[model samples]
Target: MKKKDLLKLPSVSEVLLEINDNKYHNDKYIKYIIKDEIAAFRSQAKQGSLQLDRNQIIQSILLKITKLSTASIKPVINATGIILHTGLGRAPVGKKIISKVSKRLSGYVNLELNLETGKRGQRQEHISALISSITGAEDAMVVNNNAAAVLLSLNELAEGKDVIVSRGQLVEIGGSFRIPDMITKSGCKLVEVGTTNRTHISDYEKAISSNTGLILWVHTSNYIISGFTKQVKIDELVELGRKKRIPVMSDLGCGEILDLSNKGIPTNMIVHDVIKSGSSITTFSGDKLLGGPQCGIIAGKRSLIKRIKVNPIARTVRSDKWTISLLEETLRSLRMDSINDNLTLSLMVTTRKELEKRANKLLSVIPTKLRSNHNISIQETFVEAGSGTLPGATFDSIAFKISSKKYTPAKLSDKFRNAQNPVVGYIKGNNYYIDFKSIISSQEKLLLSSIVEVLG
Candidate 1:
């Protein structure tokens, strides 16, 4: 198009009239998209780079507007083998909750209404029984996340007092969230006891004073210290707390109900045992190893949990109806022994043989020319349960390695990520690898199509 012809371009009103009549793109935001496109085209036309005619411009503008309106957050395929990959929304929630929680999302729920008496009820009642059953706690409540659980617990129990925590246990997890920071934010004075390398029970004994309010025990689930490191056991901490008449709260970052080690996946605590250790209150993540929604669970003695529930901060950090609905069902699934059907545990505990089979299936489906262009082979890979769960624990996995003559590994990874639904993987040396540990069998065809689209 010529610069002179640019003046004759359709106005924003004209374009809106043309496309706004369509039912699908009739949203109010289409005007902004149209204006932006016109401005961009005007710039291109002035620069003598405009190649398309008016019809082509309208089509392109319509496509852009439609995409902008319809596509907001595109879901991605997880080939990274980080089971609880935080970047991809952490643990992938199962669709089983869709039908179960649909009504709660779209309509009114008895979230805090007691149907029997038609009176006010507790939202915590929804998952309290389930959590108590699974963790062997006298009572339970949930918040937005584990951090909130810790924050609320400390603010309620230890605010304006001292919280004695082991220096070794004052660790940071993903997103730079530190234990010390949370304690300080809760208005509790942090009494750091013992060395980072070695924190004995005596450290707590010495830290306890007249102002001591709570003994906080943190689980270093995200990272590990090697060689000679000693941290006080939860049971011992609980005993000390009992003697001192102070509560012991264990922040088991990622809580697990099942003993994954028996299933060949290494994990720190069997959640019930942590509660059984006699901690007055225990907090953990719902999304990490428990394979539930993104929420924080606090479970332990009924009295302590009741106090935490009534804390004012509890209202701010409480889970919504949808979360309760999903969490209730997730806990139910765990009790039903059908948890392997859930995505998180399935991926975490997938055997090497299973991944090898998936890799072979993918290998068989690659087109001949595409395989030739990219040096493709199956390789042994290591998959980690991510998001601070089971730190330093790796499971054997199978991956497809693609080293292309036409594209570098980084370039290939970028191309894959730029697809409609991003496919995430890692690059080592000159090859791009997609670990099969986290990829569901149902996603194999989509993964294959994405590779063909990007590389073929």
Candidate 2:
């Protein structure tokens, strides 16, 4: 608070002189950082919360510069067993896929140039035929994400008209995006036709009118209503739409292509079946179950797809070259019956026995010093198929339960997270646990190194 104390603060030039690294030598940015640090120091000193020390202030400014220069989107190991974790970038594109795509995209290719005629081309042509072949639809297209696909479809087919949906199926996806809000934004009126727990086909029949533009059927992929539930099947709705001369649209939030029932994973209406069931248009996500880059796939009748393609909003929400190339490769892998090559599908179907073997291998590698210092053992845990793909289903998994005499569970978890290559884990019942279900075989060594570096 005294003039003399204010004079003790370091000058901006004094702080800049300490940043000798070439990367941090940008004088303008460094000066800004120094000024911001000085403002905070003045405020704290005024509140009697901090002392005005020149050396400490200079060191703090240097640290801020170092942090600012580092990359924020580096990779982290996912030890949390939740496959398709939204926080960890939903579905991870496989390294092999990335390499192949990189080779083609690193330089320019035929993105919008027609090789046959040497004329302009459409980007959607890259994935449209592939999606059609896999899903058995007349045509298909890709957008930036599922929400964009839904908005484009509604704006084209149901704008200034009634969009009928069941009350039970009105759901909210990640980031607080609700179905009703999307409908309103698309310039359509949302008409709720059934009860929350029970929706009869009669309710849909009564709700249909001349103003009905489209019949919307939403799959509650995130959650399930257990008892006393009744909703019309897609076939029945399709029949009704045929009679009423209206189009039926199905929003399968998670686009499942193959039947995973034999693998103990529950089966939803796959994309192929939805189109085969006579739905005019069916939309789903490419990132969730398809194990590809984030995008929205719209597959249905040729006429409807043609109309959707011409919409002005389609141009605004179209997928870039990277998404098209990556998704095209992913779908080709699926068509070739190479499921294991897809990382997301591989993690989802990894057996508990395999996980146990990995967990045991990890347990045997812990340094003897750490083994003596920390109490670590293998335990059984349960995790789900995250990102609203498979609801009410839990898969058995193996995890390493750890306890320390000097550190609490929360403290150990924090240490793991702050390691050079972060290992993300969870804490439960006074112990920190790292599940092996989500850890691919290649990441095992890095996981061990992180453990030794933290507990050693």
Candidate 3:
């Protein structure tokens, strides 16, 4: 097989036919997939040490095509105990409710049309009532994510004007996405008020001017400033916004509904009681603490919401009907008092007794030989609700620190990580902990079985 001839890939249409035998991609999607795959192949072969046959190249292409064709947005168990693992497609929706979304997604039914009046109605109407009632926002608009919500607000309301943010709150995330960068992109001037460690009400007060269009209070969502730190309170900031006659726009980046402290859960309480607070707007994610979809929700005064609705940027950043429809369903579930039962976050934060039950369930299937003379015991351990939600917060969770007879802690941990369903865990002082809080109920047996299989 000539290398050049081998490199000449099959027609994407032909490959598509081989994979599905019925469904075919539209010309544009086919072109994009093939172009991208071919580009990747060429880049990989640039080292010149690699050789590709026509069949091998075709196999590679077919694998990608098949993966895409049968894509169903499947669920994966979060064994890392990061309750809101943003990277692993944050917030897998509840099975039953997401099933509803999937069914409706296959066909369009009145996305914008008002069924009752036989006229056009705002798509935002679907979620408006639920979001307002739930979050106590007089009005709300949801976009792709929290960042987009923040961007949309700034672009619409503070464009070509000064937006004052705390130097303390000007934090960066995974991709070097900075608060200043977002503010700059929104056509707003970034004014840093206080130092990263400590920022006071006086710092914000000193920066206000006619150009100061928005007093941006971005939460230190992921990172925390420890001792010797002082920050403005949400209510105090709302008061400052009132005195300055400027809108206070806050980004509660992580999502939460019920106060963690009130729930007797060891998590921080930072969500501004915004519905009752006389503030212009507040934004937060639907996934993090809310345990909902990855959506950015903006809720605040009706007047400010009206302005945001009319903004040109909204069209670009606003979510589709599927997102709103699913969110509405989730919100409706909450209104009906079904959210606590259905929510993953609630399921994850288990009592010590509940944790013991789950651990014992897994232990039942754990192989005898590796169970340290068959006397393996479940012990209580501190499990942090992860992915930057609560830094120091610890929840009582149960896990088996497999005191093994056969394998070392590191070896056992590695085995589970490579399983069909990855069971991520950590070890310290020769103890391996598979936190019950992280693994799903269905996954418990699988985890135990995996350990047995590895030992066997």
- The segments of candidate 3 whose C-alpha lies over 4 angstroms from its true place after superposition are 1-74, 260-262, 270-272, 335-340, 370-379, 402-418, 426-432, 452-455
Winner on lDDT between 2 and 3 is 2
| Runs with alpha carbons beyond 4 Å of true place in candidate 2 | 23-32
RMSD of each: 2.8, 1.9, 4.7
* Candidate 3 accuracy as lDDT: 0.74
Per-residue lDDT tens digits for candidate 2, residues 97-136, read 9999999998889999999999999998999999999999
lDDT of 1 at 373: 85
| Candidate 3 clashes between residue pairs 3 or more apart in a chain or in different chains | none
lDDT: worst 10-residue window of model 3: 334-343
Candidate 1 Cα deviation (angstroms), residue 252: 0.6
- Model 1 scores a TM of 0.92
Model 3 Cα lDDT, one tens digit per residue, 1-456: 235642555666655555554655555665577667876776666645445665677678777765565444544556555556666666656777888888887887787899999999888888887788777778988888888899999988899999988888897865688889999999999999888788899998999998999988877777878989888877788899888898898887776676556444554553447546665888888877777777899998899999999898888888887788778777767632234545565665557787687777677666655676524677778766656676677777777666676678888778766665556677867767666776667566666666666556
Specify the highest-lDDT model's number: 2
lDDT of all predictions, in order shown? 0.86, 0.89, 0.74
Specify the highest-TM-score model's number.
2
Model 1, span 68-131: residue lDDT tens: 7876677788888888998887878776666667755787788889999999999999999989
Pairwise lDDT winner, candidates 1 and 2 = 2
Better of 2 and 3 by TM-score: 2
Model 2 lDDT-worst window of ten: 1-10
